[model samples]
Target chain A: MSIKDCLGIQDEELVKKSLENIDYFACIYERYEKKLIRYILRISSFSYHEAEEVLQEAFVRVWRNLNEFDESLKFSSWVYRIVHNTTITEWRKTQSKGKDRKQDIDDELYKNLPSNLNIEKELGRKIDADGIKRVLDLMPEKYRSVLILKFLEEKDYNEISDILKKPTGTVGTLINRAKKSFNQIADKENITFTV
Target chain B: MENSQKLLDKIQKENIEQRKKSEFAAKNIFFWTMFTLSVLIGGLATSVLIFAFGQTEFDLLSHITHSRVELFLGMLPIVWIFFSFVFLAASIALLRKTKKGYKYSPVLVLMGNLIMSLILGTVIYFSGGAVKIESIFAKNVPGYQSVEEKKTAIWSAPEDGFLSGTIISVENEVILQDWNGKDWKIDTKDALIRGRVSMRIGEEVKIIGEMSSEGLFKASEIRPWKGQGNGANHVNN
Candidate 1:
């Protein structure tokens, strides 16, 4: 089928086709590749190259475990879960190797953050994207990941819970705590907002 | 698009196969089975614990020299309690590993397991399954003492005003052989028999009375060996 036809097909249906023929798997891969890579970059200190590597590995795992995926869950959530785990595992391996990893937030991605985050109302000033990135870098990994999933990815609590393998209540709590932590870190850093 | 093409080419180059659906199904079934078994075993432990507490004669602590606190502490079935908690933890861990198990909060999961075990335990206890299981364990398992055995041991102290034995004869003075095979002459003229206790020959009885002399015990009250008799009828002599 053409790309237009594939675009119209749902992810769950695509998974069945992908399982039968490897060529159909390309459609699933193309659908999630960019989003998954952006998610990896947001949640970790991975470079574009490293994020691409992680996404590739994660998609391969998704292919191998296609039959294991539960139909009840949104296919995107399952893919995100695999990508999240893969990113974390890869990050841990790099840390163990004593690699000096640095946070690399894309300027384009950061520019979109303020619109999604209602922080301007609370701060009474327009906080810049760099300040948000700095505060996210300063925050703990658990809190940072939750914030990235909530604000950056625009995922709801149930979706976040599915991806993180946490209860919906715990996901809500984590997101609240993450936002609070972010404000506290921003305050500590004394980030000057452009009014 | 280029990366996707490259990955697709790599997939074609390498013979990577999707894992069978049956494999995931087996894993899910295994986790669910283990979780259910853990809860069931936990319930059994709880039932046995209830039975142990039920058979404990807390009211008879007044007759013994030891304090009530000491007797109560000594009577606690630590092994059964430990088993119950172990099974509970196992069930919780196994459940968390299952699909959608992480959807529940830890407190909710813990309470759910505990309440389920309690409900199952109460049913088992009321159905008399616990007693039968305890009896089997006591007779067959080495060093394993049933609640009845523990009760018998607690009541076997003659000097402390507690004695239990099988009645050899019911005469003017009863001849009773204690658990240790030693015979005792019990004076029952002023004794008050509690519950529906039969003073017939070969009947096991628990007496709350002091040792008057060697091999002789003065009985203040007599009760059946099984339990603190539910019957309030006091046969006074």
Candidate 2:
């Protein structure tokens, strides 16, 4: 199929075609490349270069395990799941090697956070993007990941559940707790939110 | 876009092949088989646990000790209960490894496992499977005690006004061999025989009486060794 045709086809269809022809796999990689790199950077201490490496490895794994993919799950969720696992494994490897990688969220990405988070109502003061970023960085990885997936990535509960391989109820609970934790960290840091 | 092309080019150069669908199918089948086996084992354990509880003489707690807690603790069947929960947890963990297993909450999974075990266990218990399995374990497994053996131990305290034995003879004076193979002459003339008390030879019986002398037991009441074998209660006056 042509590049235009591949772009028009759905992810599930692309996955089926990719199995028959390796070239079709390029469309799958291209489709998720940008979004997944951003996801890896948000959830891990990886730099852009390292995140790209992880994404590349993750896509290769996705290719090898294509037949194992459950047809019932959304293709986007499956790809995200692979990316999440791959990033976490790499993160652990870096930690064990005593590499102290600084987690940095892009300032531009922070500015794009949705306003519906109701952080202003919870903190009783208007909080800026930088203040939110600080609170998120200080939170535990589990809570931080859930918040990023839910609020920043604009993923629903079901999507988060599929990506994390957690129950939807657990996903909801995690998001609520993550928000509470984020607020607590904000309060503890005593960041002066501009009114 | 550059990295994407790089990956695609690498995939073509290396000729990376997708894993066969049968591998995933086999892995899924293995997990499901293990999950089912765990549940079935758990159910069987539950059945044995129920049977053990059923065989216990809870009514005789008053006779054993003043504290109900002591009697309860003594007859709790800890081994069977442990095995049941161990297998239950195993089943739950195995189920969670399946593709769609994470969709269900832990509470829901636990409840589902418990219900399946209870239903399967009850069926097995009623079908007498529990009794046969219990007996086999008691005989083969070292340090494993059956409910019947436990009951015998409870009722074998001749000095404490309880004695149980197989009847050697049931004539003017009952000749019985206690669980420890000691012979005793039981005087049941003034005894109240409760339930379906079969005073036939080789029949096992429990006597609530004191050791009058060396090999003699003066009986006040007699009961079938198994359960309160319900029938017409009689007096051997």
Candidate 3:
């Protein structure tokens, strides 16, 4: 069996093994590589090359600071936080250089995300991924990130709070505001959904 | 795929250059030591304010009930509180740079700083750290003394109030260095002296009087300074 299947273990256990033998870290990288790329693509104004750079930088930081990885937090949330910070920093650097790059949602990645979203159920309509993407592109970065994390990634409010480094209450408030913003932007863009 | 290989190579190389166990521990120790020192200093500042609040002869709780806005807001120790707050802010700012700090929200971090300062302040206050700090400021720091003097002059007004200080001279007339650091001549002819407290030179006394002139005060009542940090009573024999 490969290292990935060597042990059908928890991420935390994988992290523990990785700390001792650096080669074991490849398991973690393999697990989150695609999801993180898609996350960076959705939230950050980085080209594919820049997003790849951010992903590499983020994994590097994760590997270097694995010992500091808090056992209390989920390994996925910790990795997401590292990636989120790296992407934002890279985005800001490019922003200062007056280079604005916007990335579209990858079709394959979008298809792979969780489909049984409560947002569709709540809206009482079938909202296609293209329409959601259009609304997200029109919304501000803060609102967009919250909505994507809640709807697409299907993360709970507390997990989103941990990933975004915000208070749980603030995360709830942001999710509410993000939904309102999404609906308002969709209405303005003349996008229709059967209610 | 190729990029992951490249990053793996870099990670392995960087891991080799990572500091040793002792060095890492030393860095963390240095950070924690600095954090602790700043917190203690902040606590000391808070202790000084707590001590000052405790030194009041008047019933502060009564004032809160009867003239709360006037007493609580007007007489709040803004200077000492400001210093304590600044120190606390410094402590929290320092803590935010620590390894586990980013885990807390800013409000939670601030609340933690405040609570730690209050607990530390209470500890210092009960352990007499506040008294030592007051004396240290009074003797060593001239600037601190001047600010304290101004505060005393305003709060402990001679009109409808009293002055507490050590007796500087006791010839035919009484001369004392008032709490405001100014010398005053006390006309003590008809003053009622209470307690078995003596009239020795350098003995602390609380004199209730009105400022008669610029540099003179008339005594109505005289009593021994009978609280913490005050000299013990020596009955006149």
Candidate 4:
């Protein structure tokens, strides 16, 4: 039988199972760590830190509430939805303040990445990865998430759609748009696109 | 090359520091709780003996109220906690005022505590009539025991796994509504409900759902519809 038959299990029962059989669930996290963290980072302003914390929280939540999961919806999709909800909640905290304050933090985080990047001039003149990261950091959360899933995590269009709970077609469009946005920044920075 | 390498090295160092910082979380706060508990039990026993045998004055009213509350509703964890603290403080204060040649000694104090507690216990034990509060939302319904939930599903497993019950109609993602039965919502999440849905008919598939607080079953996990008593283990789905 598929997993959906196990839906309505008790939290205590799941916790007991998790405690007894750590490998069953631990394997899930170990396999998906990079993709999950990148997905969370794309959703949050504090990508690295928030992503780590939220990923850990999401795993703990899954571990603690395993018995609560329904098998009808794919487990990966359900877990991604929870991460999406967590990101939205975190975004709301920053968004709750006045618009000006929100925009201010946004601009600070989304500024021209290469301008801030200190690629030394005298000794070496090389295209820096950090500089590229800074520019990628500027794209809006939705677009950035798609880009990371496409390039970094190497998730396909349908998988990205499932992760973000967006329509598959929209995921495809956003990925194209995200590439365009990244290109614009790269062109403006005078960084030669190798490919 | 030197500056670029230094910058990368610095970022790497910073990332390592951040990861290490995350690792050193706040220590578990429950470790030292038992030490405090031992002191409390000892102090209570000492004070009871002192009050019963004649070392101090015993407030009979306080004893009665405490006994009543405890008997009526088992003392809450927090309430018992504050109580332990109060007793500990009072015992410390009483012992501090050690007096010589006093008529009320530990012997008399001990006797008073025992007699007062004994009397309060007797009064409370006889009053079995529970104080019932009329809930506006819960109009005279039966207790939690009256809540019953039934789920039916037929599922097939191409692979080997334990099978539960079959789901009829799922009301909510978490709450299960029978095809024609009473429905309730389950609060908890993460369950399995399995059945094939071709948009034609509902299958009698296997289900494993939890009974919820609102007297409804939630269906999260489900397998393809199939019969039970096969090879795999099964719970009522």
lDDT on C-alpha atoms for all candidate structures = 0.85, 0.85, 0.72, 0.43
lDDT by residue for model 1 (B99-181), tens: 88999999999999999999989999999988887888888989986787788777887877889989998877799999999
What residue runs in model 3 are displaced by over 4 Å at the alpha carbon? A1-23, A70-72, A101-115, A121-128, A138-143, A165-170, A173-177, A180-195, B1-3, B9-35, B56-79, B93-112, B146-152, B155-237
Model 4, span A69-159: residue lDDT tens: 5444456666776776676676667667632212113333223322443322210233344544555656677777776566545566666
Candidate closest to the true structure, highest TM-score: 2
The lowest-lDDT stretch of 10 consecutive residues in candidate 4 chain B is B145-154
Worst 10 residues of 2 chain B by lDDT: B62-71
lDDT of 4 by residue, B1-237 (tens): 332233224434553221221222211122223323434453443333222223111221132323445322322223323444555444433432322112233445445444543443334323421111112112464541100111121111111121232233444433333444434443324543222321112444333344443445444444444322234433323
Q: TM-score of candidate 2 restricted to chain B?
A: 0.81
List, residue by residue over A1-195, the lDDT tens digit for candidate 3.
134563677899988887676666777877787789888888765677877888999988887677766688888988988898888788878878987554565655455332656787654455766676666778887888888788777788778877887767778888888887887888889987532
lDDT of 3 at B203: 88
**DockQ agreement of candidate 4 with the native complex:** 0.01
lDDT per residue (tens digit) for residues A28-99 in model 2:
887788889998988887888999999999998999899988878989999999999999899989989997
Fnat of each candidate: 0.80, 0.87, 0.17, 0.00
Q: Model 3: per-residue lDDT, tens digit, B95-158?
A: 7666555456778878888888889999999999887888787788655643345345434556
Q: What DockQ, on C-alphas, does every prediction get?
A: 0.74, 0.76, 0.28, 0.01
Clashing pairs in 1: none
- Identify the runs in model 2 with alpha carbons over 4 angstroms from their true place: A1-5, A114-126, B66-74, B159-161, B167-176, B185-193, B198-203, B208-221, B230-237
User: What is the RMSD of candidate 1?
Assistant: 3.3
